[model samples]
Target: MKSNRMVLVFFILILTLWGCEEEKANKEVKTHGAYTENNVAQKMDKEDKNNEKTAKNQDDNNSVQYFIEEEDFQKFAKKGLNPFGQEKKQINLSSTDFEYYIHGMTHQKVKAKEKWDFFEMHPKRIKWLLEGLEKTKYKLGPDKQKYREILKRWKQKDFSTIVEDHNFIWDENEGTVGKATDRLSQEDEREYLESEYEMMHHFK
Candidate 1:
């Protein structure tokens, strides 16, 4: 009888220990699941904040106001004088627009082998354009750095290397140096300029 009672006691003790272990395992599983859920929530919150920040930055960039408008460029181009001519009306252009205008003007001048007399005659206008560029809201990078240097040189009344500058831009645009302006005949160049001017004014 005592032996049976001892066996019964041993069985009861075993069941109690097994129950405690199962409860401990269940608690550990719940804790792990809670930790995983918290991690997911935290990760989602971080991603949402990052997306909001990126969207805000895009909005800010899109909302930037430029000093020059397309209409202003059209009016300026219609006069058929050198873009920097002394007789032309003064128009302020943002840095970005100034860069575009300079490229078009320089390309035309180089193709036509025109004199740089406009630079000499339009000192005040050039100074005003440079000032407008200087106050632009956009950040200047390496490419724009070249424009800045050109503007500074022009401000100092030095346009001796404008042909070299034109070639540099030409090469930068992936054009062959040997065929920079040589490949285009006078008639071809004029046609190309007319098409380019129409496309620039109308498409934008």
Candidate 2:
């Protein structure tokens, strides 16, 4: 009987120890699982924030659409092709439109040898040009008086005589309108760059 009692006590002790070990193992597994879940959630949250930032940046970059309008060009056209007309009837173009216009006309898309380079600019640039007459600036020099007479003659024929024609006017004033294209002056270059940067980044 004494040996049996000792054997029973040993068996109970072994079962208690096994139960504690099993509970400890289960608690460790639960803790590890919670940690893994937390890590995954944090990673997902970080990715979501990055995605939002990317989308916001894209939206900021594409906020403004640069395109010329026919009505605006027509308004500029009503001011005539001469320097006075150009100065008085300046086309209200945003910086983007101006950039597109300047690049679209001068840059050649095709090879250097090609004479007929494609005008692969935005369709708006073409629209403003096809409307007949581009925006220009007035000059304060001896040419001003000369331009005044030329403009008078241009208006005399109900604006029918195209100054672009060499035969339409004096040889000196033949390409005068073409020469006086409206461009951002040297002083405005810095302003344009700063505005462009701000528009892209939304900087203060």
Tell me the TM-score of model 2. 0.34
Worst 10 residues of 1 by lDDT: 114-123
Can you give the lDDT of residue 103 in candidate 1? Answer: 54
Off by over 4 Å in 1: 68-204
Q: Clashes per prediction? A: 0, 0
lDDT string for model 1 (26-140, tens) is 9999999999999999999999998886675455334433223445545656775433532332243444455444554455334534322112113444465566556656655
lDDT of 1 at 134: 63
Candidate 2: lDDT over CA atoms? 0.41
Q: Per-residue lDDT tens digits of candidate 2, residues 15-134?
A: 999999999999999999999999999999999998886675455334423333456556756766412113422344333333233332322211122122112233444344323233
lDDT of 1: 0.55
| Candidate lDDT (C-alpha), each | 0.55, 0.41
Error of 1 at 149 (Å): 22
